[model samples]
Target: MSDIDFVGLLSFVPAILRVTTPILLAALGVLISDRAGVLNIGVEGMMLSGAFVGVVASAATGSAAAGLIGAIIVGGLLGAVLAGAVHILKADLILSGIALNIAAAAGTTLLLFLMTGDKGMSGSLASQVLPKVTIPVIADIPLLGTLLSGHHILTYVAFLAVPGVGIFLTRTPLGLRLRAVGESPESAAIAGINVVRVQVMALIVSGAFVGTGGAFLSMGYVSWFSQDMSAGRGFIALAAEVMGHGSASGTMFASLLLGAAEAIAVALQGRGLPSELMQTVPYIVPVIALVVYARRRQRLLARA
Candidate 1:
């Protein structure tokens, strides 16, 4: 019994990190946009588009670098379109987001047929997958080595982004301007921050990172594209952003926390539990969080 406990704990460590990456990356994306007072609803769509573009590019070029680059570019463009519709055209942000997600889903499906003659494009895309990188010396170290050095280059980038983003948002002038815009666009505009410009640019960056996150899944981790592969991760990211109260580091921590729950759920499936039941675990956390968050807010408001 003790041996089983040890092995289960061992398995959980890797699972936690692996699950954390996608949510963490997505949370950062949303954090950037929200900090500018624009809610980005197209994260899942952007991620899906990035996944398709990245996989297609990598398969065609036989280079993971090209794939990563392509995903960022495509995602940025999508964000720009979304921003234009919302900030410029005065379209409803939520509606625009939903439209983009629908477009991403259909566009990818069409491209799959045109590119590889497959409906899902899951097959051809999976053919050109990224290889795991093993650091020679670092990999030999104990727990630190495995957690820090065991993942793909993208995983390293995700971790690096945590502190970098935190510093960028807290210590930089740009960060100040972004926050000002989020707090009040009119005030930010008076301060010469160009609220629209800041929101658009920040959301574009958000899309790029989210795209890269999706690319990590398709090109870096699984190397396959599927319908709605993002699986509502965008929504979860938004929740994390709100829960973290607009701080980059705080949101990142929230993302990782939810990610850990997802990892355990996935592991539970492998233990011969009903896969559907295990899968429900990840989905349930967000619902539970929302209820708790609302209740807390109510209490605080009543006290006030």
Candidate 2:
């Protein structure tokens, strides 16, 4: 490719990363929960709640960091509630998750309306956004600088978390127990592992990760939160986790692929193409990828 063409192509890198950050973080969270056999289907709700909480907290405290913390804590509490519904109340896991999602949607909107007298958005709140980070030397480099430097702080955390999550799942003692529980709770229990405790912890940690992703949605790019601001990113993250085949690194790659699809769609807008059609690209990519992966897996299994 020509230099100009290459540079033009490279310009999309930042956008892709920006789009991928929240998905990657939430996908990692899903990975953790899935590894423990709980499979947090309420991730969507947790993310929405987190975004709402982050905005409200940041506005109240005038501190972005405080907002992020509040988001994580609320997310963890939601996870715990899910756990309680399943283990204590004997509710079905899937149904409980669905209820949580429903509740979050209505709760956030109601809370916003009560707080700001507006149900659609939070424009009146003086929320703080998370800062971007610039690597000093890297920022001065040629193409590498543009690719690596000057990203939202959460973007770095999301990428760094790939390796961090991998190590936690593969190298740590708790990781082993978590995976063992996922594989077979009966077998894990036979081995003296506390399956309930492990799964509870997994869901809580999963929610915290998801909450951080929500904070990015509100505080990373926009300084405010809106009704349904999560925009189904949590569901996309679930697809990423499924495509990752239960691996953190794989999940990261899946998130990047989905993010790229969305970024391309955004880039294509106002270029004379149908805006509605372009908006579907991100969702379509995941369905196609999942189908292809499923077919491949089936073929491999048949051959084996």
Candidate 3:
């Protein structure tokens, strides 16, 4: 620990930003659905489906943009399907989401095998990678550019979404009704709001966000899709959402914390520390954050 270069570890800031992008986007999705009273437990499946479909579309069309569009469409459709299952068919949301996740995991693997003759990954596919953006003036700056420029376009989108989602949830009439529905569906319905419609719309929007994050994995984070590449990111995003109390900016902060921990684990590799333990750091941080959040909530409740 004493030998660890603190400044060198600080370089993990860039890595933290990169790793946090997917989680930030996904957590924003979770925040929307949660605020609307529909917790999307199938976010994992939604993300996996987007990743698989994004790679397939990119490889087929030879365009990363097309791949991203395809992912958003698929993700939105899945979101609608999830909502329909809960609202129309009266299925339990949690069970339906878990089913979708199971299906996505197996479905993606089977599709990968059919497409590339390899069930593990789409490495052989000629998928285009999403372009990275170098912020104009920021990129010209010395240290600032090094810290802030050259990230994938989706990373910038994820940060931009923080404000976008915040504004939507706070300033819009629809957002007001959505919150009303979440707080009390019966009251919202009596007040002339269509509870079902609001919940469904929130879920579809959440799906679009989750899909974008999924595409970031296959199209931007890397150039190919792999089996279960989401690697529990959907769950981590959920944890972030909980830690943030469903606020967009708050979720972003929690995601950054977790991302930084993961980045440090990566930076510390092979440095005489236990590699297995290091890999657990990212996961551990979320658990700790949740515990802290719960304690704070308890303290607030006690005071009240």
Top lDDT prediction, candidate number: 2
Q: Tell me the number of clashing residue pairs for each predicted model.
A: 0, 0, 0
Regions of model 2 farther than 4 Å from truth: none
Report the lDDT tens digits of candidate 3 across residue range 97-153: 999999999999988888789987656765699999988999898667868898889
RMSD of each: 2.0, 0.8, 2.2
Model 1 alpha-carbon drift over 4 Å, by segment: 1-7, 131-136
Q: What is the per-residue lDDT of model 1 for residues 141-249, given as tens digits with 9 covering 90 to 100?
A: 8665666566777777887898998888889999888888999999888888888889999989999988888887787657778767777777787788777777777
Best by TM-score: 2
- C-alpha TM-scores of all predictions: 0.93, 0.98, 0.95
Tens-digit lDDT string for candidate 2 (17-110): 9999999999999999999999999999999999999999999999999999999999999999999999889899889999999999999999
| True lDDT of residue 264, candidate 1 | 82
Q: Give the range where candidate 2 is weakest over 10 consecutive residues by summed lDDT.
A: 118-127
Q: Arrange candidates by lDDT, highest first: which order?
A: 2, 3, 1
Instruction: Write out the backbone clash pairs for model 3.
Output: none
| Model 3 bad stretches (over 4 Å) | 1-10
TM-score-based ranking: 2, 3, 1
lDDT of 3: 0.90
